[model samples]
Target: MYIGIPKEIKNHEYRVGLTPASAHELVAHGHKVFVETHAGEGIGFSDDDYRAAGVEVLATADEVFEKAEMIVKVKEPQAIERARLKPHHTLFTYLHLAPDAEQTHDLIKSGATCIAYETVTDTKGGLPLLAPMSAVAGRMSIQAGAHSLEKAKGGRAVLMGGVPGVEPAKVVVIGGGVVGENAAEMAVGMGAEVVILDRNLDVLRRLAKRFDNRLKTVYSTSKALADHVASADLVVGAVLLPGAAAPKLITRELISTMKKGAVIVDVAIDQGGCAETSKATTHAEPTYIVDGIVHYCVANMPGAVARTSTMALNNATLPYALALADKGTKKALEEDKHLLNGLNVCKGRITCEDVSVALDLPYVPAEDMIKEL
Candidate 1:
């Protein structure tokens, strides 16, 4: 099988989908790997490194996209790349199609086998491919929020970890999943008064146990979420609904009641945000003031730390890429039920239920589509 790795073209997104080590492994398995020139450069891997690993380098994205049977990518295809997609071509990436009607329509019309990394489930019902980036984004959420809270950044003129005799900033993290957990960990390490909210009692109990009472675990109800947000110096929106739009837990009215110059890092911005005021921002201009509250809603939080993000993402995604390369998408997905869950769109049909429901489209069973293929 011929596999392609294209340089990410998303605004300020510098992560590459594959690394030299990944190319080496695929080449060892008798699969041809075509990497777009400079794809791994931002991730600190040179073209020579890819060549050393026995992977061929292409000069343009068009060459890689046009030739490869399967394209392994870091992000969803942007408009131009989506136009380049061909029928039956396999696109394996983080396609957050639930909220983007245009992207959904484009993927549906492309007639491609689109497997979203974010939708892939493990045996334990965790998003395997999405977890690594989620972890990165979660950690970065605090870092970004902290910066946004600085006096120079129009924040409440406070530090996350205060000086001697001064109280640290209060951090409220919504959700206790991978994103919220990592956010709480970062905030706690920074000496902030950290509180995490989640509906799952078991998850909250586990977090309480793990944190040794250093952190507060609140049972997330509408009232609880509102109360925490009202007093939070920094609120991290980490909620997710796997392949669906993130729920608007923080309404505009709720944000209006927050402290003046409070910062909100909506990590769920990629899948639409958990805040009513959240709009996708870029790293260049990642924050905006709304109702005296600062909203930091960068869609690609990991992109700010591209090298670390690319390597971490490659580590998590390489195994699945190798599986697809070694066995083909059909054989690998058909054989592994977990991988089949990743199938968002296949042969021009919506195969993921959440995505279909979110977009108000028809949901077709992946097994049924596999049979047709």
Candidate 2:
């Protein structure tokens, strides 16, 4: 099989799909790997490094996309990238298609096999491929939120971790999954009064035990979320529902109740956000003020720290990539039920139930499509 790695073309996106080490592994398995020029540069891997690993370096994305059977990418295909997709091509990436109708339509029309990393599940119902990047985005949410709270940024001018004599800032994190847990960890480490809310009592209990009262866990309700927003200096929106759009936990009315100059980092922006005012922003211009509240809704938060993000993402995706490349998507997914759940769109049919329901498209069983393939 011929594998292609393209440089991410999304705004402010610097992470590449495959690293030299990944290419090396594929080469060892007798698969031909072609990497777009400068794809690994952002993560400090040179073309020479890929060449040294027995991977061919192509001069343009066109060459890589045109020649490879399977294309591995870091993000969903942007408009320009989508135009390059051809029928029967395999796209393996983090395709968050639930909210992006345009991309979903394009992929379906192209008649390509689209396996979304974000939809892949583990035995425990956790999103396997999204976990690494979620961990990165969750931790960075606090760092970005804290920066947005600085006086220079037109924030409330209060420090998250106050001086010895002053009280610390209050942080409210909505969700108790990977993103929420990491956000809470960062906020607590910064000495802020952190409160995490979720509907899951089991998650809340586990968090309570892990933090040992350093961070507070609350049962999430509309009233509880509204009340917490009023007093929070920093609010992190981290809710998720697999391949569905994130629920709006913080409405425009709720923002009005929050203190003036409060900072909100909506880490769930990739899944259409948990905040009513959230819009995908870029790193170059990451924040905007709405209803006297500052919103940092960079859709690709992990992209800002590409080195750390790329390495972490590769760690999670490499094994799956190997499996798919070795056995083909059909064989691998057929054998691994967990991976079959990752199949979103293949051969002009929608396979994931959540994505189909979110987009109001027909849901076809993955087995039906895999058998044909």
Measured against the true structure, the TM-scores of the candidates, in listed sequence, are 0.98, 0.99
**Where does candidate 1 have its weakest 10-residue lDDT segment?**
364-373
Give a tens-digit lDDT track for model 1, residues 88-207.
688999999988989988998999999999988899989989998999999999999999999888899889999999999999999999999999999999999999999999999999
Deviation (Å) of 142 in candidate 2: 0.4
| lDDT for position 65 in model 1 | 91
Model 1 TM-score on a 0 to 1 scale: 0.98
Q: Going through the candidates in order, what is the number of backbone clashes in each?
A: 0, 0
Off by over 4 Å in 2: none
Cα lDDT, all candidates: 0.92, 0.92
Alpha-carbon shift of residue 17 in model 1 (angstroms): 0.7
Clash pairs (backbone) in predicted model 2: none
Model 1: residue 141 alpha-carbon error in angstroms: 0.7
After superposition, candidate 1 runs with Cα above 4 Å error: none
Q: For model 2, what is the C-alpha lDDT against the true structure? A: 0.92
